[model samples]
Target: MGLIISIIIGLIAGAVAHRVLNSRGGFLGNLVVGLIGALIGGKLAEMFRLQVTGGILDQLVLATVGAILFLFLWRKIRN
Candidate 1:
């Protein structure tokens, strides 16, 4: 299902982002961040006119980048 795939992608993306950024968060946290990151990444891609094909790889990359950016900003804002 579409929803299931999205969740899986989100989890993977979040985990990857957390690993890359060396941030602390559990499964639920990663899922939340990943979903939000996907949204942010989608909007950014649209705004920038980036051609993101409907592929798992593309989505994963975008989501990971977005998650990293989100975590980075969150840390900055919190501190």
Candidate 2:
């Protein structure tokens, strides 16, 4: 199902982001970050009118962008 696939992608993206960003969190935290990132990425893509395919690679790309943005904001706010 689409939902299931999305969740899997989110999880993977979260893990990748956490590792890349050196974020401190467990699996659930990573998942939350990834999910939020997905939402942010989707909105950003829409705002910028970016065209990305509905595939795993596309999701990963969006999630990475979202995660980067989230991490940047998180650091700024935490400071």
Every candidate's lDDT: 0.91, 0.83
State in Å the error of residue 11, model 1.
Answer: 0.4
Q: Report the lDDT tens digits of candidate 1 across residue range 1-79.
A: 9999999999998999899999888999999999988998888899999998979999988888899999999999999
Stretches off by above 4 angstroms in model 2 are none
Please give the lDDT score at residue 3 for candidate 2.
Answer: 84
Q: Which candidate number maximizes TM-score?
A: 1
Q: What lDDT, from 0 to 1, does candidate 1 have?
A: 0.91
Q: Which stretches of candidate 1 lie above 4 Å from their native place?
A: none
* Residue range 1-79, candidate 2, lDDT tens digits: 9888778777877787888888776878778888888989988999999998877899878987797688769889999
Clashes of 2: 0
Error of 1 at 5 (Å): 0.5
